[model samples]
Target chain A: MKLLPWDYGVRNLLRAPGRTALGAGGVALVTALLVTAAAFVRGMNGSLAETGGLRNVILLGAGSEDSVERSEVKAGVAGIVAASVPGIEERLGVPYVSPEINVALVVNVDGQERQASFRGVTDAAYLVHPQVRIVEGRAPRAGELLVGRFAAARLDVPDERLAVGRSVDIDGRPWTIAGRFEAPGTVLDAEIWCDAQELRVATRRETLSGIVLTLADDAQTDDLDLFTKQRLDLELVALPERGYYARLHDFLAPVRAMVWTTALLVAGAALLGGIDTMHASFAARIRELATLRALGFANGAIALSLVQEALLTAALGALVGAACVLPLDGLAVRVSMGAFGLRVDGTALALGLGAACGVGLLGSLPAAWRCLRMELVAALRAD
Target chain B: MSALVECRGLTRVYHKGDQEIRPLDELDLDVDEGTFTALMGPSGSGKTTLLNLVAGIDRATSGTLRVEGVELGALSNTELARWRAHTIGYVFQLYHLVPVLTAYENVELPLLLRDDTRRERHRKVAAALELVGLADRHDHFPRQLSGGQEQRVALARAIVTDPRIIVADEPTGDLDAAAADAILDLLGALRRELGKTLLMVTHDPRAAAHADRVIHLEKGRIVAAAAATS
Candidate 1:
């Protein structure tokens, strides 16, 4: 069937500037909220997913498998695992074993106290986790701290407070920030790293939080499991690093669900408001619609024209929303696991635009149906 | 003359909370081709109903309505709309010019239904505007035009598709005397010059005087038929 002129729909939007702006502004707000929620979920999930090394294994205390922060491996387990596990990956004859401690400590930065995630590691961590790169200065020695790029966001402080040569007070003692490191898209990007020996002394802890070791290309996780089982007296459990992070991801499923549920509720409300707005807008044009029908345009054609108007408004809103969201990319957001940047990636953008179009299409239906359902004679008589 | 609009026992029933109201009750009428006829009646009479039935914009609850030899009641909604696009041009009492479109675009609306290129549509639109004596006001929107000019643009829209019959409902009801006379003269010109079969519903005797024949209705049935003197 033939359609109405495209300019007809476009011109109708300009007829009532205030109503059009209000409708578009509502849609823009919804689109922005949807994109931000999508970005939040993507960033959180991505941080956990990207943090794990495919061939690395974590040896945690048997009962503490759920959380490395609570896990306490015997301090000597890293050396024992290196000697017993035949397929351990080694570089320059030094096995890739990082005995690490993970803790959440209250640190003072620029006179403000904040809780920050701290990981104690040796040089072996760089060998096992290849994604980390020291972008500034050098690794932290004793009485010094290596700050992640997102450490400031995680600490809720200014970036300059975490910069090299600045001091962060730990356990009431000032530790110089020696350097900065970046592990993009990973949870490690939000942590402050120091010497494992120093952290042990600072906390007076006798056990390591966990031992992370990389396996050779030919090695399977079964080799590490075998070693852990044979040395059961050590009370160690072998788990793939990826599997650990996956468990953490599953543990946070409720948080993701809450985020999605909240976003959907708000979007649903916005959709309803949009429909109401469109209904009023179309109701005012019932006679004009009927006049078109009287001129031999079918109801379907008229309805399509209304949809075109709505889609145009929604497209404008989507552009504004997308522009508003662009600056949020790579901006850090802190969670209990540390911090991750809001990923305004292509996938998130697609979802935002798809939702806007969906709003436009679905929002116009009830109004169109209401306006078109009237008998042509009655509609023409309507005031 | 052959009958262009034939109505046999035409009826229209409306229901309001268990009450059945028949606007046109078993009415029979015939409108000949190339003739101008006006329907006159008081409020609640089915003059406008009959006009709508002939224009194929409303369906009869019962009975047959044939416009230009096509059985309107037998056709589906889509077919009826298509038939209306090809055969009928409707003029509303309010002129009903789409407010957002310019005079030229308002007149171009009916032709958009056909498979015409932009240049072809522009040609038809220009000719229609010129015929209505508003070619210079083509760029002005309905709000920018006077009531008479808007009615003329509406007339241009009605005839843009060159339909065989034009159905007008109180075409001069909302205009002043001078404006109403201009519209009536255009309505007469449509019948005399273009040979269009014109069926108009009007409340004014002066407007009815322009028709070749006048049919008066009361309580949904034609009560009198007379030839116009003017």
Candidate 2:
């Protein structure tokens, strides 16, 4: 059957500017909320997923495999593993083994105390985790500290406050900010790093938290496992770096679920409001709809016209919502684990727009059915 | 001549919470081709209901309604709508012009149902508006027009499709005396000049006087039939 002219639906939206604005604005807010929730989930998952090196393994105390911060290996374990493991990668005769200490410390920044992730590392960390790149200044020396790009966000401080030459008090002693590093899309971007020997001396730690070792291309993880098993007296466990991060992601599944549930509930309420607005709009046009039917237009044609009107309104809303969200791309968001940037990427945008259109299509159905189901003669008689 | 519209034992029933109301009960009538007929009756007399059934906008609960040799009762709703597009032009008392559409666009609505080209549609719409003496006001919306002018636009919409018959329900019911007279004169001109069959329902004798024949109804049955004095 023939449909109504496209301009018919377009012009109807202009009949009541206030109502149209209300409907469009509701859809816009829902779209923006959905985009933000998507960005949060994506950013969090991405940060965790990108942190682990595929060819690396972690050697930590067997009982503390869940959290490296709680894991303790002997301070000499890095050298022992590099010598015992046959497949440890070597560059210019130096083994790719990093003895690291992962700790959470309360630090005073600009007179404000904040809990921050602190990693004590040797130079081998750059060899194993290639994603890390120092963008400015140099690696931390003797009593200095290296800050990650997102460290300021995690510490709730301004970027200028963490620049090189600034000092933060750790263990009641001030450590100079010597450099800045970036590990994009990784949780490490929100941690502070310092020389392991100095950190051990300052914190009075007797053991290293863990040892991270990269394997050569021909090497298998089975080799590391075999070495760990043979050296059981060391009380060490060999775990793939990727598997550790994956477990961490699974541990945070409930947070993601709560995020989605909350977003869905709010979006659902907005959708209902949109439906009510459309119902009111269409109900006021019952007589006109019936007149079209009486003039030989089919119910399907009229319904299509109504849907077209809804889609146009929703598209306008989606455009506005997307514009509002574009500037938020890569915006830093702080969580308990660390800080990750809100990723308003293409997938997030697609989901937001898809939901807006879905609202438009679904919101119009009840109203269209109610208006079109009326008896033509009675509808013509309606005011 | 054979009747263009024939209704035999036509009945329509409505139910409201266990109460059955019969608006038209087994009414029989015939409206000849190329003639203007007016149905006159009181408020629940089924005059408008019969007009609606003839226009194919409403259905009879039982019995037969034939327009141009097609049994309207036997057709499906979709089929009836298609048939209505080709066979009938309905004019409502309120004019019922789509508020968003200009007079030209309103008149062009029914023709869009057919496969007419844009030029062809424009040609017919322009002629219809010109015939109704609103050619100069083609771009004016319904709100921009006076009551008589709006009804004329509705009339223009009714005839734009060039259907075989036009059914008008109280076409002058909402108009002032002078406007009502002008609409009646135009209705008369449609039948006289175009040879188009007209079926109209009106409570006003002055409106009925424009018809070639007037049928009086009470309690769903035709009480009297007479030639118009005019």
lDDT values for all models? 0.91, 0.92
Candidate 2: RMSD to truth: 1.6
lDDT of 2 by residue, A239-270 (tens): 88888888899998999999889889988998
Report lDDT (Cα) of residue A220, candidate 1: 87
DockQ of each: 0.84, 0.83
Regions of candidate 2 where Cα sits further than 4 Å from its true position: none
Worst 10 residues of 2 chain B by lDDT: B1-10
Worst 10 residues of 1 chain B by lDDT: B1-10
lDDT by residue for model 1 (B1-230), tens? 55888899999999999999888999999989899999999988999889888988899999998887888998988888888888888888889999999999999888988998999999999999898899999999999999999999999999998999999999999999999999999989989999999999999999999999999998899999999878
Candidate 1 chain A lowest-lDDT run of ten: A223-232
Q: CA lDDT of A101 in candidate 2? A: 94
Residue-level lDDT for B9 in candidate 2: 98
